[model samples]
Target: MELDPKALALFKEGYDKIIEGIKTLGFDVTDENFADTAARAAKGLHELIHDQTQVRKDVDALLAKTFPAKYTEMVISKHNTCFGVCPHHLLPVIYRISMAYIPTEKVLGLSKLSRLARLIARGPRLQEDLTHELADLLHVNLASQGSAVYIEGLHMCMAARGVGAHEARLVTSGVRGVFLELATREEFIKLVVAPPTTLV
Candidate 1:
Protein backbone atom coordinates (compact mmCIF):
# COMPACT_ATOMS: atom_id res chain seq x y z
CA MET A 1 0.00 0.00 0.00
CA GLU A 2 1.20 3.49 -0.86
CA LEU A 3 1.89 5.74 2.08
CA ASP A 4 0.92 9.35 2.04
CA PRO A 5 3.92 11.42 1.01
CA LYS A 6 2.84 14.33 3.15
CA ALA A 7 2.59 12.15 6.24
CA LEU A 8 5.99 10.63 5.54
CA ALA A 9 7.52 14.07 5.29
CA LEU A 10 5.96 15.06 8.61
CA PHE A 11 7.26 11.89 10.27
CA LYS A 12 10.76 12.64 9.04
CA GLU A 13 10.48 16.10 10.54
CA GLY A 14 9.44 14.60 13.84
CA TYR A 15 12.36 12.19 13.82
CA ASP A 16 14.73 15.02 13.06
CA LYS A 17 13.45 16.84 16.13
CA ILE A 18 14.04 13.69 18.20
CA ILE A 19 17.62 13.51 16.95
CA GLU A 20 18.12 17.16 17.96
CA GLY A 21 16.71 16.36 21.40
CA ILE A 22 19.21 13.54 21.79
CA LYS A 23 21.99 15.99 20.89
CA THR A 24 21.18 17.95 24.05
CA LEU A 25 22.24 14.86 26.04
CA GLY A 26 25.69 14.97 24.33
CA PHE A 27 24.81 12.39 21.65
CA ASP A 28 26.43 13.36 18.36
CA VAL A 29 23.67 13.10 15.75
CA THR A 30 25.84 14.74 13.09
CA ASP A 31 28.41 11.92 12.92
CA GLU A 32 28.80 10.20 9.53
CA ASN A 33 27.27 7.00 10.96
CA PHE A 34 24.11 8.90 11.93
CA ALA A 35 23.53 10.60 8.55
CA ASP A 36 20.50 8.53 7.54
CA THR A 37 19.36 7.62 11.03
CA ALA A 38 16.47 10.07 11.11
CA ALA A 39 15.13 8.94 7.76
CA ARG A 40 15.38 5.29 8.65
CA ALA A 41 13.74 5.84 12.03
CA ALA A 42 10.90 7.75 10.41
CA LYS A 43 10.29 5.02 7.86
CA GLY A 44 10.40 2.27 10.45
CA LEU A 45 8.03 4.10 12.79
CA HIS A 46 5.59 4.76 9.95
CA GLU A 47 5.51 1.08 9.04
CA LEU A 48 5.06 0.09 12.67
CA ILE A 49 2.02 2.35 12.85
CA HIS A 50 0.58 1.62 9.45
CA ASP A 51 -2.42 3.60 8.24
CA GLN A 52 -5.41 2.68 10.41
CA THR A 53 -7.91 3.20 7.59
CA GLN A 54 -6.01 0.74 5.43
CA VAL A 55 -5.82 -1.70 8.31
CA ARG A 56 -9.56 -1.54 8.79
CA LYS A 57 -10.02 -2.12 5.07
CA ASP A 58 -7.80 -5.16 5.20
CA VAL A 59 -9.75 -6.51 8.18
CA ASP A 60 -13.07 -6.01 6.42
CA ALA A 61 -11.77 -7.87 3.39
CA LEU A 62 -10.67 -10.80 5.51
CA LEU A 63 -13.97 -11.01 7.34
CA ALA A 64 -15.76 -11.01 3.99
CA LYS A 65 -14.20 -14.40 3.20
CA THR A 66 -16.15 -16.37 5.78
CA PHE A 67 -17.64 -19.79 5.02
CA PRO A 68 -20.86 -21.35 6.18
CA ALA A 69 -20.44 -23.60 9.20
CA LYS A 70 -21.90 -27.12 9.00
CA TYR A 71 -22.22 -27.28 12.78
CA THR A 72 -22.31 -24.79 15.61
CA GLU A 73 -19.24 -25.36 17.73
CA MET A 74 -16.62 -23.42 19.58
CA VAL A 75 -13.75 -22.30 17.36
CA ILE A 76 -10.52 -21.39 19.05
CA SER A 77 -7.32 -19.93 17.65
CA LYS A 78 -4.44 -19.79 20.10
CA HIS A 79 -0.94 -18.30 20.35
CA ASN A 80 -1.45 -15.68 17.69
CA THR A 81 1.68 -13.65 18.24
CA CYS A 82 1.32 -9.92 17.61
CA PHE A 83 3.36 -6.76 18.11
CA GLY A 84 2.28 -3.22 18.93
CA VAL A 85 3.63 0.04 20.31
CA CYS A 86 2.60 1.35 23.69
CA PRO A 87 0.93 4.71 23.32
CA HIS A 88 2.19 6.04 26.63
CA HIS A 89 5.89 5.21 26.39
CA LEU A 90 6.21 4.46 22.67
CA LEU A 91 7.80 1.11 23.53
CA PRO A 92 7.14 -2.22 21.86
CA VAL A 93 4.65 -4.70 23.25
CA ILE A 94 4.64 -8.40 22.42
CA TYR A 95 1.31 -10.16 22.53
CA ARG A 96 0.15 -13.74 22.58
CA ILE A 97 -3.55 -13.76 21.80
CA SER A 98 -6.16 -16.50 21.97
CA MET A 99 -9.65 -16.18 20.54
CA ALA A 100 -12.76 -18.31 20.74
CA TYR A 101 -16.18 -18.02 19.21
CA ILE A 102 -19.33 -20.09 18.85
CA PRO A 103 -20.56 -19.74 15.32
CA THR A 104 -24.17 -19.07 14.48
CA GLU A 105 -24.07 -19.68 10.73
CA LYS A 106 -20.77 -18.54 9.25
CA VAL A 107 -17.20 -18.79 10.48
CA LEU A 108 -13.94 -17.12 9.58
CA GLY A 109 -11.14 -19.07 7.90
CA LEU A 110 -8.88 -20.51 10.59
CA SER A 111 -5.79 -18.57 9.55
CA LYS A 112 -7.83 -15.41 9.33
CA LEU A 113 -8.17 -15.46 13.10
CA SER A 114 -4.42 -15.02 13.57
CA ARG A 115 -4.26 -12.46 10.78
CA LEU A 116 -7.06 -10.52 12.39
CA ALA A 117 -5.17 -10.35 15.65
CA ARG A 118 -2.03 -9.08 13.96
CA LEU A 119 -3.89 -6.52 11.90
CA ILE A 120 -5.65 -5.07 14.92
CA ALA A 121 -2.35 -4.93 16.81
CA ARG A 122 -0.33 -3.11 14.15
CA GLY A 123 -0.57 0.26 15.89
CA PRO A 124 -0.23 1.91 19.28
CA ARG A 125 -2.99 0.66 21.61
CA LEU A 126 -3.68 -0.53 25.12
CA GLN A 127 -3.95 -4.26 25.83
CA GLU A 128 -7.34 -3.86 27.43
CA ASP A 129 -8.68 -1.99 24.42
CA LEU A 130 -7.24 -4.51 21.99
CA THR A 131 -8.88 -7.44 23.79
CA HIS A 132 -12.30 -5.84 23.74
CA GLU A 133 -11.94 -4.78 20.11
CA LEU A 134 -11.06 -8.29 18.98
CA ALA A 135 -14.06 -9.80 20.73
CA ASP A 136 -16.35 -7.11 19.35
CA LEU A 137 -15.15 -7.69 15.79
CA LEU A 138 -15.64 -11.46 15.88
CA HIS A 139 -19.02 -11.29 17.58
CA VAL A 140 -20.41 -8.53 15.40
CA ASN A 141 -18.81 -9.18 12.03
CA LEU A 142 -19.39 -12.95 12.00
CA ALA A 143 -22.78 -12.75 13.70
CA SER A 144 -21.48 -15.38 16.08
CA GLN A 145 -23.43 -16.75 19.01
CA GLY A 146 -20.56 -15.60 21.23
CA SER A 147 -16.95 -14.52 21.09
CA ALA A 148 -14.07 -14.21 23.56
CA VAL A 149 -10.55 -12.83 23.32
CA TYR A 150 -7.70 -13.45 25.75
CA ILE A 151 -4.34 -11.74 25.54
CA GLU A 152 -1.06 -11.93 27.43
CA GLY A 153 1.16 -8.93 26.78
CA LEU A 154 4.79 -8.32 27.59
CA HIS A 155 5.22 -4.55 27.61
CA MET A 156 8.63 -2.99 27.13
CA CYS A 157 7.58 0.00 29.20
CA MET A 158 7.26 -2.29 32.18
CA ALA A 159 10.22 -4.55 31.40
CA ALA A 160 12.92 -2.12 30.27
CA ARG A 161 12.03 0.80 32.57
CA GLY A 162 10.12 1.89 35.66
CA VAL A 163 10.62 -0.89 38.22
CA GLY A 164 12.37 -3.01 35.57
CA ALA A 165 10.13 -5.99 36.14
CA HIS A 166 11.26 -7.93 33.10
CA GLU A 167 9.15 -10.97 33.91
CA ALA A 168 5.91 -9.02 34.19
CA ARG A 169 3.09 -9.94 31.86
CA LEU A 170 -0.36 -8.36 31.56
CA VAL A 171 -3.33 -10.60 30.94
CA THR A 172 -6.66 -9.31 29.71
CA SER A 173 -9.88 -10.80 28.36
CA GLY A 174 -13.14 -9.73 26.76
CA VAL A 175 -16.24 -11.82 26.27
CA ARG A 176 -19.63 -11.46 24.66
CA GLY A 177 -22.87 -13.40 24.45
CA VAL A 178 -22.66 -16.96 25.84
CA PHE A 179 -18.99 -16.49 26.55
CA LEU A 180 -20.12 -14.18 29.37
CA GLU A 181 -21.43 -17.25 31.15
CA LEU A 182 -19.22 -18.44 34.00
CA ALA A 183 -18.71 -21.99 32.69
CA THR A 184 -17.94 -20.87 29.17
CA ARG A 185 -15.49 -18.24 30.42
CA GLU A 186 -13.72 -20.76 32.62
CA GLU A 187 -13.40 -23.24 29.75
CA PHE A 188 -11.78 -20.61 27.55
CA ILE A 189 -9.35 -19.59 30.27
CA LYS A 190 -8.47 -23.22 30.99
CA LEU A 191 -7.65 -23.92 27.38
CA VAL A 192 -5.61 -20.71 27.09
CA VAL A 193 -3.41 -21.60 30.07
CA ALA A 194 -3.08 -25.28 29.14
CA PRO A 195 0.21 -26.64 27.86
CA PRO A 196 0.65 -27.09 24.16
CA THR A 197 -0.01 -30.58 22.81
CA THR A 198 3.02 -32.61 21.81
CA LEU A 199 3.65 -32.72 18.11
CA VAL A 200 3.57 -36.10 16.52
Candidate 2:
Protein backbone atom coordinates (compact mmCIF):
# COMPACT_ATOMS: atom_id res chain seq x y z
CA MET A 1 0.00 0.00 0.00
CA GLU A 2 1.11 3.56 -0.63
CA LEU A 3 2.23 5.30 2.53
CA ASP A 4 3.26 8.71 3.78
CA PRO A 5 6.99 8.77 4.36
CA LYS A 6 6.63 10.52 7.69
CA ALA A 7 3.79 8.26 8.70
CA LEU A 8 5.79 5.24 7.54
CA ALA A 9 8.71 6.30 9.70
CA LEU A 10 6.47 6.92 12.67
CA PHE A 11 4.77 3.59 12.04
CA LYS A 12 8.16 1.87 12.27
CA GLU A 13 8.93 3.70 15.51
CA GLY A 14 5.50 2.89 16.90
CA TYR A 15 5.82 -0.72 15.79
CA ASP A 16 9.06 -1.10 17.78
CA LYS A 17 7.36 0.46 20.81
CA ILE A 18 4.39 -1.90 20.51
CA ILE A 19 6.62 -4.92 20.13
CA GLU A 20 8.69 -3.86 23.09
CA GLY A 21 5.56 -3.32 25.21
CA ILE A 22 4.05 -6.67 24.23
CA LYS A 23 7.35 -8.46 24.89
CA THR A 24 7.74 -6.71 28.20
CA LEU A 25 4.31 -8.04 29.11
CA GLY A 26 5.64 -11.54 28.28
CA PHE A 27 3.65 -12.14 25.14
CA ASP A 28 5.22 -14.20 22.39
CA VAL A 29 4.97 -11.35 19.85
CA THR A 30 6.68 -12.04 16.54
CA ASP A 31 7.09 -10.58 13.07
CA GLU A 32 4.37 -12.77 11.58
CA ASN A 33 1.94 -12.11 14.43
CA PHE A 34 2.66 -8.39 14.39
CA ALA A 35 3.03 -7.65 10.69
CA ASP A 36 -0.41 -6.05 10.40
CA THR A 37 0.04 -4.24 13.69
CA ALA A 38 2.22 -1.49 12.23
CA ALA A 39 -0.15 -0.92 9.33
CA ARG A 40 -3.15 -0.62 11.61
CA ALA A 41 -1.21 1.57 14.01
CA ALA A 42 -0.13 3.85 11.19
CA LYS A 43 -3.68 3.97 9.86
CA GLY A 44 -5.10 4.95 13.25
CA LEU A 45 -2.44 7.57 13.70
CA HIS A 46 -2.99 8.95 10.19
CA GLU A 47 -6.75 9.29 10.58
CA LEU A 48 -6.43 10.95 13.96
CA ILE A 49 -3.84 13.45 12.84
CA HIS A 50 -4.98 14.08 9.26
CA ASP A 51 -7.79 16.43 10.20
CA GLN A 52 -5.85 17.82 13.12
CA THR A 53 -3.36 19.12 10.53
CA GLN A 54 -3.73 18.88 6.74
CA VAL A 55 -7.52 19.00 6.84
CA ARG A 56 -7.46 22.32 8.60
CA LYS A 57 -5.34 23.65 5.76
CA ASP A 58 -7.93 22.36 3.31
CA VAL A 59 -10.61 24.30 5.16
CA ASP A 60 -8.43 27.37 5.20
CA ALA A 61 -7.84 27.14 1.45
CA LEU A 62 -11.54 26.82 0.75
CA LEU A 63 -12.26 29.83 2.88
CA ALA A 64 -9.62 31.89 1.16
CA LYS A 65 -10.85 31.02 -2.31
CA THR A 66 -14.46 31.85 -1.57
CA PHE A 67 -15.91 34.86 -3.40
CA PRO A 68 -18.60 36.90 -1.76
CA ALA A 69 -22.01 37.93 -3.00
CA LYS A 70 -25.00 39.82 -1.64
CA TYR A 71 -26.85 36.78 -0.39
CA THR A 72 -27.46 37.82 3.17
CA GLU A 73 -30.10 35.23 3.93
CA MET A 74 -30.11 32.31 6.31
CA VAL A 75 -28.51 29.46 4.42
CA ILE A 76 -29.67 26.16 5.88
CA SER A 77 -28.53 22.67 5.10
CA LYS A 78 -30.21 19.96 7.13
CA HIS A 79 -30.44 16.27 7.79
CA ASN A 80 -26.85 15.62 6.76
CA THR A 81 -26.05 12.28 8.35
CA CYS A 82 -22.88 11.49 10.34
CA PHE A 83 -21.49 8.19 11.63
CA GLY A 84 -18.41 7.65 13.81
CA VAL A 85 -16.97 6.30 17.05
CA CYS A 86 -17.06 8.23 20.29
CA PRO A 87 -13.70 9.47 21.60
CA HIS A 88 -14.60 8.35 25.10
CA HIS A 89 -16.00 4.88 24.48
CA LEU A 90 -14.84 4.20 20.92
CA LEU A 91 -18.51 3.35 20.51
CA PRO A 92 -20.47 4.69 17.59
CA VAL A 93 -22.49 7.87 17.53
CA ILE A 94 -24.72 8.09 14.51
CA TYR A 95 -26.32 11.43 13.92
CA ARG A 96 -27.56 14.14 11.57
CA ILE A 97 -26.10 17.65 11.32
CA SER A 98 -28.06 20.76 10.44
CA MET A 99 -26.27 23.99 9.56
CA ALA A 100 -27.38 27.51 8.73
CA TYR A 101 -25.47 30.69 8.16
CA ILE A 102 -26.59 34.11 7.05
CA PRO A 103 -24.01 35.15 4.57
CA THR A 104 -22.38 38.50 4.98
CA GLU A 105 -20.29 39.05 1.86
CA LYS A 106 -19.32 35.40 1.40
CA VAL A 107 -20.99 32.04 1.04
CA LEU A 108 -19.30 28.67 0.98
CA GLY A 109 -20.13 26.16 -1.72
CA LEU A 110 -23.06 24.06 -0.61
CA SER A 111 -21.18 20.78 -0.66
CA LYS A 112 -18.27 22.20 1.35
CA LEU A 113 -20.72 22.53 4.20
CA SER A 114 -21.12 18.76 4.18
CA ARG A 115 -17.38 18.35 3.64
CA LEU A 116 -16.83 20.38 6.78
CA ALA A 117 -19.14 18.06 8.66
CA ARG A 118 -17.25 15.04 7.38
CA LEU A 119 -13.89 16.51 8.35
CA ILE A 120 -15.04 17.37 11.85
CA ALA A 121 -16.50 13.88 12.28
CA ARG A 122 -13.23 12.13 11.49
CA GLY A 123 -11.94 9.66 14.08
CA PRO A 124 -13.43 9.25 17.55
CA ARG A 125 -15.19 12.39 18.74
CA LEU A 126 -17.61 13.60 21.36
CA GLN A 127 -20.93 14.55 19.83
CA GLU A 128 -20.79 17.87 21.66
CA ASP A 129 -17.33 18.71 20.28
CA LEU A 130 -18.41 17.56 16.85
CA THR A 131 -21.38 19.91 16.92
CA HIS A 132 -19.43 22.94 18.04
CA GLU A 133 -16.47 22.38 15.73
CA LEU A 134 -18.63 22.33 12.62
CA ALA A 135 -20.40 25.47 13.71
CA ASP A 136 -17.13 27.15 14.51
CA LEU A 137 -15.78 26.31 11.05
CA LEU A 138 -18.88 27.76 9.42
CA HIS A 139 -18.88 30.85 11.58
CA VAL A 140 -15.20 31.46 10.99
CA ASN A 141 -15.16 30.51 7.35
CA LEU A 142 -18.17 32.49 6.27
CA ALA A 143 -17.39 35.46 8.50
CA SER A 144 -21.14 35.61 8.39
CA GLN A 145 -23.75 37.59 10.16
CA GLY A 146 -25.05 34.46 11.82
CA SER A 147 -24.25 30.79 11.97
CA ALA A 148 -25.81 27.91 13.86
CA VAL A 149 -25.30 24.20 13.94
CA TYR A 150 -27.31 21.59 15.74
CA ILE A 151 -26.75 17.89 15.98
CA GLU A 152 -29.06 15.10 17.07
CA GLY A 153 -27.32 11.80 17.69
CA LEU A 154 -27.96 8.34 19.06
CA HIS A 155 -24.80 7.33 20.85
CA MET A 156 -23.80 3.70 21.24
CA CYS A 157 -22.58 4.76 24.66
CA MET A 158 -26.22 5.10 25.56
CA ALA A 159 -27.91 2.72 23.15
CA ALA A 160 -26.97 -0.55 21.41
CA ARG A 161 -25.38 -1.68 24.76
CA GLY A 162 -26.08 0.39 27.82
CA VAL A 163 -29.47 0.93 29.56
CA GLY A 164 -30.85 0.95 26.05
CA ALA A 165 -32.54 4.31 26.08
CA HIS A 166 -33.05 3.48 22.47
CA GLU A 167 -35.23 6.53 22.13
CA ALA A 168 -32.75 8.80 23.80
CA ARG A 169 -31.00 11.01 21.25
CA LEU A 170 -28.62 13.76 22.37
CA VAL A 171 -28.91 17.32 21.13
CA THR A 172 -25.90 19.63 20.83
CA SER A 173 -25.63 23.08 19.31
CA GLY A 174 -23.25 25.94 18.53
CA VAL A 175 -24.26 29.46 17.60
CA ARG A 176 -21.94 32.30 16.63
CA GLY A 177 -21.72 35.78 15.03
CA VAL A 178 -25.16 37.27 14.55
CA PHE A 179 -26.52 33.95 15.61
CA LEU A 180 -25.20 34.91 19.00
CA GLU A 181 -25.59 38.64 18.52
CA LEU A 182 -29.25 39.26 17.77
CA ALA A 183 -32.63 37.51 18.01
CA THR A 184 -31.37 35.44 15.06
CA ARG A 185 -30.24 32.69 17.39
CA GLU A 186 -33.76 32.09 18.69
CA GLU A 187 -35.18 32.34 15.18
CA PHE A 188 -32.68 29.89 13.78
CA ILE A 189 -33.22 27.50 16.68
CA LYS A 190 -36.97 27.72 16.28
CA LEU A 191 -36.75 27.22 12.57
CA VAL A 192 -34.43 24.25 12.89
CA VAL A 193 -36.59 22.70 15.61
CA ALA A 194 -39.81 23.65 13.82
CA PRO A 195 -41.82 21.65 11.32
CA PRO A 196 -40.03 20.89 8.08
CA THR A 197 -42.60 22.17 5.62
CA THR A 198 -42.70 25.55 7.27
CA LEU A 199 -39.56 26.53 5.36
CA VAL A 200 -39.79 27.29 1.69
Q: Number of the top candidate by lDDT? A: 1
Q: Write the per-residue lDDT of candidate 1 for residues 1-200, one digit (tens) a residue.
A: 45767778898998889888999999877788889887888777776677888898999999999899998989999988898888998788999999999999999999999999998987789999999999999999999999999999999999998585899999999999999999999999999878667779
TM-score of each: 0.92, 0.70
lDDT for position 123 in model 2: 62
Model 2, span 1-200: residue lDDT tens: 13367766776687778778988998877757776776776675555434456667766776676667666889988877767678777666777888998887888888878777766776677888888878777777667776899888888788876675977989999988888865887877777776456346
Query: Mind sharing the TM-score for model 1?
Result: 0.92
- lDDT (Cα atoms) of all candidates against the true structure: 0.90, 0.75
| Top-TM-score candidate index | 1
Q: Cα-based RMSD of the predictions, in order?
A: 1.7, 5.4
Error of 1 at 138 (Å): 0.7
